[model samples]
Structures are given as C-alpha cells and as structure tokens.
Target: MKRRKFLKNSSLSTAGIFSASLLASCETDKKPQVVNKMIKPIVIATWDVLNATNKAWQVLNNAGTALDAVEQGVMIEEADINNQSVGKGGRPDRDGNVTLDACIMDKDSNCGAVLYLKNIVHPISVARKVMEETPHVMLAGKGAELFAYQKGFKKENLLTEKSKAEWLEWKKTSKYQPVINIENHDTIGMLAIDSKGDIAGACTTSGMAYKIGGRVGDSPIIGAGLFVDNEVGGATATGVGEEVVRTVGSFLIVELMRQGKTPQEACEEGVKRIISKNNEKLDFQIGFIAINKKGETGGYCIQPGFTYRVYSEQGHINKTASSYISS
Candidate 1:
C-alpha cells in the first residue's frame, strides 16, 4: 500500500511538472500583439482643395487605406473642369497640347508616375496602376497613354472648350511664364495618414501655362513633387516645379522630419533651401506642405497668400500657410 501511494504521488508530481513546463514553453513561444496606436487619420492638400480633402476623409472615415484615400481624393480634382491646373481643363503647353503629370507613393516605398501624358483625365489613377501592375516607376508621353489604354483607361480629349479658347488667346502673346497667383496654382499635391498609421502621397499638375511641349516638372518626380517615408511621414511641393526639383524639396522635408524637426520647421527649412539657391528676384512662388508620423501638419511658402486644406477627426478647415516672403 505504501509503495502504491508513493508511486501515485510520483506520477502526480511528474504530471504537474510536465504541465508547468508546457505552460512555460507556450508562454515563451507567444509574441506580444502589435497593435497600431493610430492618431486621428488626416488628409491634407495644397491650396483650397476642400472637396478633395472631404473625399479623402470619406475613405479614412470608412477605414480605407491611405493609398486609396489619396487616389480617390485627387480624382475629384482631376475630373473637375474648373480646376484647370490639374486635369481635364488644364491649360495647354506651348504647342497647344494638354499634358498631365502625376506621381503616387504608398507606404511600402512603392511609387509610380506618368509625365507628359495626354488625353487621360485621371493621371493619378494611371500612376497608381504603374505602382501596382507594372514593374516601372514611370511611363512618359505616348508610352504612358498607351499603357493607360492597355489597362482599360478610356481615351478622351482632356482639353475642354474653355481651356482651348484660353490657349488660342495665349498664342497671341506666345510669351511663356510660370504663373504663381492662386487662380493659376500649378500642382495639386496631397498627403494622408490612415487609421492604420500608413502614409501615402500624390502630386498632379498640368505643367506651367504655356510651358515648352517637352518640359516635365516636379509633379511626376517622386522625391521632388511628392515623397512619403511611411515610417517618418510625407511632404509635397506646389508652385514652381523647377526649383522644387532642383532641391528634391519633398524628400528634404521628410528627411528633416526624420531627424526630429516638426513638420512646420521642416517646411520652413525647405523654403529656406530654395531661397538659398536662388539669388535672383523671388518673383516665382514655392510652397512646401508636410505631415509627420504623428499627424502633425505644416506648410511654408516662398510668397504670401499660399493656402492649404486639412481634414481630420478634429475638423475640416482651410488655413493660410505662413510664408517666407510675408503673410
């Protein structure tokens, strides 16, 4: 009886030890869940693009990804005939061609762009396809249009009657200059952070009024017109494309944010960089808008009267950005 009792106790102890060891092993194998501590999802864009921001807010409010939000948001402006700087009604190049340039960057560093693409009203969508469907980052001119066609994009004349009439009148002077006034703002660049904390950006424009036919601006260039680091944040440039491209403006603001600058500070530094490079009269304008990883936003411009629109859980409003020239 004593031996049997001792054996029973030994078995129970062994079982208990085994259970404890198994529990320890399970505990060691389990990983802590990585929940994203998301701030309020926000959408920001250059100029008074409230409609576009609200469209983006619609996506974010529905838990859509940042990439989708930016794409859908900008498509509104692209289809709007009154917004001549962006899509269907954009002014023509010197040869009376209505060319569009656009670029999109998503969280994983994936990007796509189309430069000098004609006849496609929604170049932002085309850029997204170039990101997802193709191995190339950019397609240009006729090649871009062909790619759009192959991808089932409808080909329609992008030049509206109003734009064509304006182009015809512009031919009288044949004088070429980049216009900086609000009515003639050049690029519609947008950035967003989603509910999952992912970042994305898109920039689109018709090149400056009466620009050379073959000229491409910062709009379709990834680091120049728009840049998103995902882990850091995103930045975009509006106004003069050449100066922005020369300094890789958008990328610079993002890097500055990574190095601990607030979005506002980074944008101010960006405008300063452009100023440092140009000694000539600052007749042209440049605006840099930045959003950091925390959803903090800022905008700085080379000239006064620049504006930006913001939409978030807090609210939606249009605010004038402080300028290097004056406010």
Candidate 2:
C-alpha cells in the first residue's frame, strides 16, 4: 500500500509540472508583437536648390504624400523668375520660343510627362495632372497646352523680360557654347520620401539654351531624367540631357540600388556608363543624384562644380559635392 501511494504522488507531480510549462508557453505566445518604426522623411534635389528643398520639406513635415511634396517642391523653382534654367524666366530656344519639358513619377510606377509645352507657367503641375488624370504617359506641344488649359491651368507667356534680353544678347554672339550650371543647368530634378516611406520624383526644365525649337531632352523622359521605385530608390539627372538619355541614367541608378548597391555606388555607375559609351569624351558635363529607400543620398558628375542638396532628420540642409569630376 505505501509503495503504490508513492507512485501515485510522483505521477501527479509530473503531470502538474508539464501543465505549468504548457501554460507558460501559451502566455508567452500571447504577448503583443512589435512593429518596425518608420524613418523620418527626406528631400533631395539635383542642385543646391535650397528654396525648393525647403518647400518640399514643408510638405513632408506636414505628413503630405511624397508625390505632392515633389511636385510642390519643384514648382517653387518653376515659378522663380530669377531661375533661368526652369520655370517662368527660363532661357528661350534658338527660335526665340520658351518651350518647357517636365516629368513626374510615383512609387506605383505611374508616370506622366509633357515636352515642348508652351505658355504654361508650371509644367510640373501639368505633369502631375497628366499622371493622375490620363491613361497616356506623355503629351507634347499643342496637345499638352490644350490639356493644361482644359485642366484649368492658366495660359501665360513663360518668357520674362530678363530672358528676352538675354536671348537678344545671345543672338548677337550666335555662339552655342554653354557653361555648365551657368547657362546649361538644364533642369531641376527633385526627389522626396514622405513620412510614410513612399517615394516620388519630379524633373522640370526649359531644356538646353539655344536648342532648336521642339527639342525635347531627358527631362521629359521618365527613365532618363527621373525614376522612382519605392522598393528600391529614386534618381535624377542634370547637365547634358542627351548623355543622360542615351544611358537611361536614372533608371540605371534605381536598378543598381535594387541590386544591393548604395546610392553613391549607383550614381557613380551611371556616370561611368556615360563615359564608356561616349568614347570620344563628352564636351559637356553630366551629373546624377540618387536617394535610396533608406533615405541615404549620393551624387556623381563627369565634370567639376556639380553639387546637390539633401535634407533629412539628421541634417537640415547639406550641400555636398559629387563623387567624381573629370580632369
């Protein structure tokens, strides 16, 4: 009888221990799960266009969408009468016409563009409307103007008195030489990542000074002047748009990021591609700026004097030089 009682007690204790262990395991599993915290917003642009960057930062600061932030940011530059490479006071073409080109892209791969568009003060806004309202990816010339007018955008002369005077001066010389960043800044390419981590980009320009009428450069082309892939990153180009178009530079940088390269590495690769393809060496400069999904930024250029502006939580506004400048 004593031996049987001891065996029964041991079995009960064993059962109780196993039940306690199971209960503890269940409680642990029921604990709340943790989610990843969102990173702060970032704004980056091709030039030290701090005014535009600050405008973009306001959108991001207010928790606005990335697409809206990029559009609003570049629009500031587009409206600045002092800025000769973009917006209202931009340089005229060889025919004394103020034609504009612009493109916008979102994380969902939706993009829109307008090329050779005339008499529109804000081409970036028109590009956004095209992306949101139309099925087609691009509209050009009078068609773009019609669309802009239909969409309630005012039709006004884009050329300013200062621009006209400069055009007259150029006519006297008839020289086509373009000094980088002075006469040939080409475009303002802006990229932004909102608080929600969504990415978008915009590129707007009056194209090359003295370019032939109806000339469209990389600024209006999605993969060339601007590209955005939310999962990977975004990139934009400036300087010589033709060189950028030939290499599909912005798209190449995004792909490089997807392939695990850093933003700097990707931008450098874009510059190298341009160099390799133009074996005869380019007479003009070409530059690329990129921002990764993590909000890290980088830039590279074929010639010296290329710079970019970056804004992030860690830094307010940083003016950084490109990685490479040809000798």
> What is the C-alpha local distance difference test score of candidate 1?
0.91
Which candidate gets the maximum lDDT versus the true structure?
1
Report the lDDT of model 2 for residue 219: 96
Local lDDT at 172 for model 1: 79
Candidate 2 global Cα RMSD: 10.6
Off by over 4 Å in 2: 1-38, 175-182, 323-327
What is the C-alpha local distance difference test score of candidate 2? Answer: 0.87
Per-prediction TM-score? 0.87, 0.86
Q: Tens digit of lDDT per residue, candidate 1, span 1-327?
A: 699999999999999999999999999999998756867799999999989999999999999999999999999999999999999999888788999999999999999999999999999999999999999999999999999999999988988899999988877765556444444655789999999899999999987877777889899999999999988999999988889999999999999999999999999999999888987358788999999989999999988899999999988989899988532
**Runs off by more than 4 Å, candidate 1:** 1-38, 176-183
Please give the CA lDDT of all the candidate structures.
Answer: 0.91, 0.87
Give candidate 2's error at residue 264 in angstroms: 0.2
Clashing pairs in 2: none
